[model samples]
Every structure is written in structure tokens, then in C-alpha cells.
Target: MTFQYSRSFAHQLDEQDTLKEFRQWFHFPTNAVGEDQLYFCGNSLGLQPRTAKQALDAELEDWAKHGVEGHFHGKNPWFHYHKFLTQHSAEIVGAREHEVVVMNQLTVNLHLLMVSFYRPTASRYKIIMEAGAFPSDMYAIESQVKFHGFEYDKAVIELKPRDGEHTLRNADILDAIEQHKDELALVFFSGVQYYTGQLFNIKQITEKAHSVGAIAGFDLAHAAGMLTYNCTIGM
Candidate 1:
């Protein structure tokens, strides 16, 4: 199949897209001369939603009106603020509502989850992860390993692509899991590589990890809104 390759063709497709109206819900940045710029950085810092200003204004109004009472008396009470996001967030990530929770930033959440999942033992204490993971993930794993009284060099296994290659092969990843099964305590990886844009086979990786008696986890910073997966499944 061939796709039309022209600005007019692209515009025509966009006009017919059912999600086209959603674009107006976000506030896009402008250039130096005040022309609307085409932004594509949603993979990192997403553009602010147009409704955000109204939401923030309402919060400010509540603070001014209720002061100490604002925690429980407002359009959206602060005490249960995160609850409003649970269902929508679960839908976005294809997870059950109970399986998801609104939390702090990505790295902070990773660290929090790691605290519960990354249990390292004297005999089975190794962590397997991609070599070129985001610095935050690498840092989190390194700190966890060190805190567990294990040296980073000995306890962390970084899987790399073959020489002259840019991405990890699925077979290589599975083979590494099997090869290091005995000492593996955790298998952590990214849903999508940050730099290379390679989407890993998450389900397979998770299964491989489980087969080896290891806990499987992923840093979904680059994957959350960009990819879809069935969280009800093992992955």
C-alpha cells in the first residue's frame, strides 16, 4: 500500500481524523515572531492543556475563598484530588483502575516502585536492564543495587546491542535472561528506548523474567501516551 505524500494530502487526512478536535484542547507554543510552532515534544514534556488555566484558576479561587478549609471544601477538594485521575489514567495505560495510582514524577515513581519490587538477596541479587537506558532509570537501579550492599559492577547486568548496531534484538534479550537466570532478581527495562526509538517486546521480556523467577518492571516515560498494551495481561 502507498500513502499520499503531500502537504495537502496530509491536511486532508487530518481534517477527516476523528481526533482532530482534540488538538485545540492543548496550548501550543509560538515562534519568536509569534507564529504558532509545530511542536512534537510530547514524548518528554507535554504541552499544557488549554483547560489547565481554568483548573488552576479555580484552585486559586478556592484557596482564597476557603483558606484552611480548601482541602475538603471546593469544586475539587484537595483531599481526594488524585482519585479524579485514577479512572482516566487507567484507560490511557490500559490498566485496571485498582492497578494504577497517580504519583509523583517519573523518576520518583520508578524509585518508589523499585523499593517494593527490587528485593535483592545474597545469592540471587542481580538486576538486568538495557545498557543505554535513560540516565534517571540507570541512576535509580544503580542506587538500589548499592543500597542493597551490592556493587554496581557485579550486581547490575547491562545488555547491549551487537557492535555497529543501534537497538537490542529480542532474541538477545531473552538469551541474556536465560543465561543469567540463576542470579537474576529483577528485570527492568524501558517500554521504548529513549534515543533509538526502538519499542521493546515488553510481554516477551516479562514472560522471560517470570520464567527465571525474577520480577519484571519497566520505565514507561517514553511509552505511556505513545503506545498501547494490555496491562491486564502479565506485561
Candidate 2:
């Protein structure tokens, strides 16, 4: 089913939206000529919340007032600041607080996960991923394979859409797993394909990988915040 949009339609939507009042909580950018630009880049970087300034100012005030003791005594203590962010983050990813941590940037965390999960064995040491994964993920996986003393070409297997197709079929992915069952060690794919916006059937893929005695994981950068679902369904 296709949908159409126009200024009038958008206005109607804005009028009916329950969260319309929350629009006042942002600072949308204006052009040099002082006109508000129609910003459409939230997929890259979200607009700053209007509350951010007040939040930061409060933190600054706490720091100035408490100095070294602010780590434990501030209104929002710096010592456990990241912990405060974790509950919401866990809810976003559909994970337990213990399973999630806000640490390094995306690729850095990917590399760290690879170190723990990419334990290649002698007979089954191959890692499968999407053909056009984000460059950072590709680089991280390549480096991980090399770090574990495997050649890039031999260690990494990239699944591509079949000829004349733009998106991968679930059957194709299952076939790849079946074909390489003996050699496959890990099956990792993006939860959502960044380019095509394809949300992979994560539960199905994970089940297939497990059936083939392979470990499965996902990069959830694109899937989070836009959709409501449970990650626990796959497991």
C-alpha cells in the first residue's frame, strides 16, 4: 500500500498527534536568512532537545559548587552518570540492563564484541555478514579476522542479494548457512540494512544459525528508536 503526503496532510497529522506538544522541546535550526529549514537528517544526528542546555547548565553549576566531591555528591553524580543512561538505552534495545553498556562509539563496541564472540576454531572459523554492511562494521570484522590469524578472503563470507534483486531473501540466507554449515562459526548481520532500510528477520536468521551450530549476533544501530519490538523473541 502506498501513501501520499502534502502540506495539508502533514498539518492534519500534526494537529492530531498526541505528542504534538513535545515539538516545543526542540531547538530547530534556522538558516542564515532566519528562516527555519525543513530539517530531515535525524537518521544521522537528532536535533538537540531544548532541555539539553538547562541540563548542561545544572551540571556545570554542580561542578562549580562541589568541585572534586561532585563525582558522588552532585544532583546528578558523575560517578554513576552512565548508569543513569543505561535504563532507557536497555529499553530501546529490548535488552536487560546487564546485557547493555554505554561505552565506546559504535565501531569500537563492535570490535570489542568481536573479540569475545568471534572465537574462531580450527574447523569452523568463518564469519558471515551482509555484502554491503556499514563500512565501519566491515572494517571491524575484517580486522577481527586478521587479528585471529585468518585471511580476510577466507574468514569473512558476505551474503549478497541474488541477481536482479535489490534485497536479500530469507531462503537465500538459510541456503548459505546450510551450504557452509561445517565451516561457519558466526553469523552476524545488521538488524536493519542501512542502505535499503531492510529489516532482516532476526529471529529466523538467529534460529537458522543456531541450527547450524553457529553463533548469531546483530548490529542494531538502524533498528532502535524507530520501531517497537522485543529482541527476546529470537532467543
Candidate 3:
């Protein structure tokens, strides 16, 4: 099981991977010269699925045939389109069907969810999050705090790695929550940090946040299909 730095070793591992065949499901990017490019930027946009063309064509055809009636009648009714994705989406995130709702853009959904959960009293108005969070999340938290007449620095606790370190330690995260137990109103974080590719310990973070009477929330933008784990990971 020794790891080697060679093309043959890479091929060997790929040959043994159980998920090897899944790669063909998407069309990888190709350079202008017709060479396939390596892509790892799933944080923002994922590779287009090969079936996307056929799928879009089907929907377009339905729209042309049914017109406005497509909302009520079609291969997949637009009125109940979200329902069609509910079960599978719920299963992927390890949440009950009732707890999951697929709607709105990510930033919009994030802002709405924060508004509902982040009720900040003067006494308990601090939010804890990773320092270099996704830009949308950072802006969302900033606006939420500002909307409530609180300054970003005073209201939000941006957790940073120690000197010379690249990622956060579990103890540091838990300790921060404990330290701000009294003032902590919300523990908001990205499910998988886009910059560092660090998949956090969600369960432990939630437990710590709850032990101190604070609520924990996650924006699983990159984690829904990108995160790879043997079992379910949830709050």
C-alpha cells in the first residue's frame, strides 16, 4: 500500500477506485487544443453533467408543447418541480423531508435562514464563524449584524488559525464557543471551507454551540455533493 509519485501509481489507484465510473457522468473541461484540463473548483461551479443537454431539451420541448399549461401538465410539472427533488436532496444532506426546502438562490436562502435563527439580544449578540468564510456568507453576516444596529467587529467573532497554521484545530473551535458562551447568539459556518477544503466537524460544533445556549447553522453550499464521507455528517 505504499504511495508512489508516478503516473502508473496514479492510474493504479484510479483503476481500483469504486467511484471511477462516475467521472464519465460529467463532461470535463477541455483546453482549446483539445486536451482535458484538471478541474478542482467545485466550490463555485461544478462540471456540467453529460446528460444536461438531453435534460434541458426535454424541458424546452415540454414548454413549447404545453405553454403556460406546463406548470400544471408536463413530464415534470413546474408547480410541483421542487417536490420532485425533495426526497433525494433531503437524503443527501441527512435531513428529514420536512426539514428540507429547495428554493431561492443560496445567498437569499442564507439571509432568510439567518434572519430566522439569529435573533440577537443586546446581551447575547455575538456570532462565531471562520475568518475567511465564503464571501456571500461573510457579507450576509455583516448585513445581519449591521441591520440590527451592531458593528461587524463587535458583533461577530471570526475564528482564525494560530500563528503559522493553515487550518483551525478542533479544540480552538470548541474553546471559542465556550469562551463566548454568554454572548454567543449564533454559530454560523460554511460546511466545507472553499479556500482550505477543510471539512469541519459539524456534530461537535453543534454540540458545543448548544451546550452554551447558542444556535448553530450551516450553509452546505459545497458539501451537498462535494463532501465525501462514509456515513452521514450533520448537525
Candidate 4:
């Protein structure tokens, strides 16, 4: 069979997509010459929505109009500001409102999550991750393990793809989990591998981790908005 994914076909697909309206909400940037540039790096920094300026203006107006009172009295009170984003974020992550909190930046969030979830005892004190996880995640895990007084070699396990393979197979991952069942404390993986764009079998991996008495979590920067996966449902 021949593949049909040309620009015209993609535009046609966009025409029929239910989320077509959302495209209008974003402010896709153009090149210096005024041509719309292909933007495939939303995984890093997303395109700003056209309404962002207006939103910022509203916040500035609040600050100007209310000063310190803006914390409680402004149109968008800073006191409850994060709460406004919480419900939408919870829905996106497939979590209960109480289970989700939007506070810091991505790596900061990862570190905070690890503080609660990566509790390592003498016996089960190892954190397992994919070999080529994002640099920020790698740093967070490494520092957390070292901070807990465990040697890097003993505290962190990196799972590599088999020889000649560009992506990991589900069996290989599960096998690794089985091999380290007794020593594993947490299994953390990117929801989608950033470089290869391979989506891990998060639910299955999480199930195996739980079966072996390990906590499981994911860094979802690449996967969010691209596809829907439910962590709560998987749990």
C-alpha cells in the first residue's frame, strides 16, 4: 500500500478533525520573510496562543488596579490562580484534582514528585529509567539518588535498547523489571521517548512495576496533547 501524507492530505485531515477549531486559538509564528514556518518543536516550548497577550494584559490591569489586593480581589485572583489551571491540568493527565497540583517548572515538578515517590530503603533503593531519558530527568534522578546517600552505581539503573534496535520492546522492559524486582524502588520513564518518538507501554509497565512492589511514574512533556493516556486509570 502507498502512504498518502502530503500537505494537501494533511490539510484535508485537519479540515475533518474535531480539534480543528483549536488551531485558530494558537499564534503560529511566521518567518522573517512573512511565510508560515513549519513548527515541529512544540515538545520544547509550545506556540503561544493568540489570546496570550490579552490574558497578560488582564493580569497587568489587575496588578495596576488592585496592587497588593490583586492577590485576593483582582479579576483573576493570584491566591486562587493555580487552582484555576488545576482542573484542566488534572483532566489532561487523567488524575483526580487532589492527585494533581501545578506548581513549579517541569524538572522541579519531577524533583518534588521524586521526593514523595522515590523513597528508597536499604533493600529496595534503586531507581530505574530508560537509558536515554531527557537530560533534566537524568540529572534529577542522579542528584536525588546521590542525595539519599546511595552510590550512583547501586542507586540508579538505566535500561538500554537491545543491539541494533532504535526502540525498546515491551518484553525487554518487562524482563528488566523482573530481573531487578527485588531491588527496584521506582520505575520512571518518559511517556514518549523524546528522540525516537516511541510511546512506551506505560500502563503495562506500571502494572508490572506495581506487581513487583515498585512505584511507577512518568515525565509527560512530550506526550501531553499529542495523545491521551490515563495514569489514574492505569493505576
Candidate 5:
């Protein structure tokens, strides 16, 4: 059935939604007059959940009562801190529990992933990326190539749209990967382009990279919680 495009239709759908109760769990900002505001910037910073405060308070109580023992004795132990997130994170990203881990911020994770996957050989030394990537990615890749004794310009292949175009075409991306296949050691792209908000063809991109013997990696800072796609990292 086609979804009707009206406020009443939206409200009807919301009323029918099984997960509607979850919406009340999130904390929304309100104006001075106490009207709830519509927020569209979750892409940048997600709003704090109402339950988060209670969870945090419980942790504080544990710390006050147990001190360092809280690491082992708390409701969610700090000793295996990352374990708390693994299964849920895996489900969100559509991966196995063993295939995912939560760590530092986006840049730190990018550097860590690149450290293992960005190994460069004499012939296969180039990295293919979007023309205007998030700043952290551009910096990390540049520094990585330079650390391996290759000049930035020669070692990094950035794919840009044709003149008068704002976003990349899939054909152009595939062609670029094929054209640079011999030199490409890795194909790194944003899961969703931050500037253009473009969701890439992840599966085809990975296949192309593998066909040409290049490892594929993705920066999912913007993609996670925004949409679902199958992604293989460090392969």
C-alpha cells in the first residue's frame, strides 16, 4: 500500500507502529513555552535518551558504594566494558557478534583499522577514496601513505564528480576502481557521504575491490543508526 502524505496519515502510521512506545523513551528538546521541538540534527549528535540518566545514576551509586570494586561488581561491569555493547552493536550493523567491537571515536577507529588493513606493497601502494571525504579520513589516509614513504598525491586516488555534478555516480566510482586496480591496495569510502548524504552501493563496491585484489573498508560514522547495509571491514 502506498503511504499517504499527510500529518493525519503520519499520526495514523505512528499509532499502528509496534515500536511507538520507544519514542517516549527519548528526551526531546522543548522551547521556552514548553512545546517539543522537531530535531533534525541527530546525524551530528544524537539526543540523550531519558533512560540514560537513570543508567548513569546507577553507575555512580555503584562507584560510590564499591570504588574500584565497581569494575567487577557493578550492574554492568567495567572490566569487560566493551562486551556490554557487542551483541547489540552487531545486530544494528548486521554482523556477527565476533565481527564487531565498540572503541574510540571515528578517527581513532579509522586509524586503528587502517593500521592493520592499509599495508602497502611496492606495486600495490595506492588508496582510493572519495574526493571530499570527512576531514579525519583525508588526514588519516594522507599521513598513512606518507608514513609508508609514498607521496600523498601519487599514493591517494580521489574520485571526484564530473564538472557541474555535485555527487559521485556509481559508474564513475566503479570505473575509477577498475582504472586504478593495479595500484590500489585499499578502497575506503564513507558508508554514507556526509556532505551529499549519499548512501553508496556497498556490496558492489566491495565486490569490485575484491575482484581487483584490493581490500575494502568503510567509515560508518554517519551510516550507523541511519540505515542498514552489509559491510566487511579489515578484509
Candidate 6:
């Protein structure tokens, strides 16, 4: 689609959107005049879905009736709740269902994953990631390396764009991974850079890390829902 810089153009594009009607499924905040406010804060937290209250109420009623047994007795058992979400969540992230687990929130899950993947040893322990990753990522990586007896400054290789550039180039990322291949334990990156809105090539990054004998992990908070998995992948 050609770019246009007018509200009418935006409206026309919206009109043509196949999923435009899905807007009614969410509860948008209204202004003082009771007009629906223009919203762009979804990256932080999404607008509540229209059926959210009903869903929550059902779970509340189930809890009231089943008590602690709700884990195994409710319509949606709490014990296996993540299993029910696996397929849908996998599709959103373009991953296999078995590879998905819809459990804890981002930071919690990231730390849990680090426990399994960020195994630092005498030789290979460094992590290469974008310089301006989300604060959660920075803190999580920092804490993980520190916990494993590595200095944050020395263990983490933060990649930034070249001078006067806005976003990082794929070549630079791969080169960094190669440059530190011997010391690289993890190539952690954000699927979509939060600040710049630059989408990284996940498949290439994953393959590059694997090629360098490093584990690759991506924080896909902003990518899921906002981005589409249109590229072909090799089996």
C-alpha cells in the first residue's frame, strides 16, 4: 500500500481492513466528552476485551463452587490451564504448539528460561543483545549474569546501530555473534525492538546463533499480535 499522510487515508485503509470489526471486541477508554479515545498504549497493556468480565466472572463462580479443587474440577482446570492456551499462543508467535507454554508473565518466564538456557561456564558465558532492549530485558539479563558470577559490563555485549543510524542492521548483529562465537553462551534479542519498532529477522538470528554454538532467545512481547508470520521457514 502507498503511504498517505491524512486521517481520511487512514480511515479508508481501516475500512478495507478485514479484521476491522474486531475493534468492537475491546473496551476502549472514553474521554471527558464520552468519545472513544485514540489509543496507542497496547505495548504496555491491551484494552480489555468486551467479554473479559464475563470470562472472569465464570472463573470466579467456579472458584466459589469448587474451592481448591478447581484445579482439577472446574470447566477450565487451573492445573492444566496453560495447555488450553498452547495452540492459540503458538500460532500468534509462529511457533509449534509443543514449543509454547502460556504460563507466567514476561519477566518471570524470561528468568525461568534463563535458568535453563543461560548456563555460563569457564569459557563461554557472554550474552549479545540490542543495546536499547526493554528495561525488563536489561535487568533480567543483568541479574542472570550476576547470579552466575559474571560482571554485567563484561558478560553482556550490547549491540547498537552505527553512528547516525536509528536501528541496527542484521549484518552487524550476525557479525557480533560471530566475533564472540567462542565466548557466546546466549544471543538474546527482542523480536521487535520496543523503542525503534524495528522488527528483527528471527529465523536468521536463530540460525546464526545455532551456527555459532550459542543458544538464541527472543522476548516477543511487542511482536506477538502486532506482527505477522509471513516468511517461509525451512524444516
- Report, for every candidate in turn, its global Cα lDDT versus the true structure: 0.88, 0.85, 0.87, 0.86, 0.87, 0.89
Candidate 1 lDDT over 108-130, as tens digits, reads 88888888988888899999899
For model 4, how does the per-residue alpha-carbon lDDT over 53-154 read when each residue is reduced to its tens digit? 999999999999999999999788999888998888888877778877778798998888888888899999987889989998999999999989999887
Q: Could you tell me every candidate's TM-score relative to the true structure?
A: 0.91, 0.88, 0.92, 0.89, 0.87, 0.91
Worst-scoring 10-residue span by lDDT in model 5 = 226-235
Q: Of 2 and 3, which scores higher on TM-score?
A: 3
Which candidate tops TM-score? 3
Candidate 3 has an lDDT of 0.87
115-234 per-residue lDDT for model 2 (tens digits): 777789889999888999998989988988888899989988899998999999989898898999999989999888988889898888898899999989888888876777755521
Model 2 residue 154 CA deviation in Å: 1.7
For model 1, give the 10-residue run with minimal summed lDDT: 226-235
C-alpha RMSD (angstroms) for model 1: 2.0
Any residue pairs clashing in model 5, and if so which?
none
Model 6 whole-model lDDT (C-alpha atoms): 0.89
Model 3 TM-score relative to the real fold: 0.92
Per-residue lDDT of 43 in model 4: 69
Off by over 4 Å in 6: 1-6, 230-235
Count clashing residue pairs in model 6: 0
Off by over 4 Å in 5: 1-19, 230-235
Location of the lowest summed lDDT over 10 successive residues in candidate 2: 226-235
Native-to-model Cα distance after best TM-score fit, residue 207 in candidate 3, in Å = 1.2
Better of 4 and 6 by lDDT: 6
Model 2 pairs in collision: none
- 4 versus 6: better TM-score goes to: 6
Could you tell which candidate, 3 or 5, scores higher by TM-score?
3
Residue-pair clashes per candidate, as listed? 0, 0, 0, 0, 0, 0
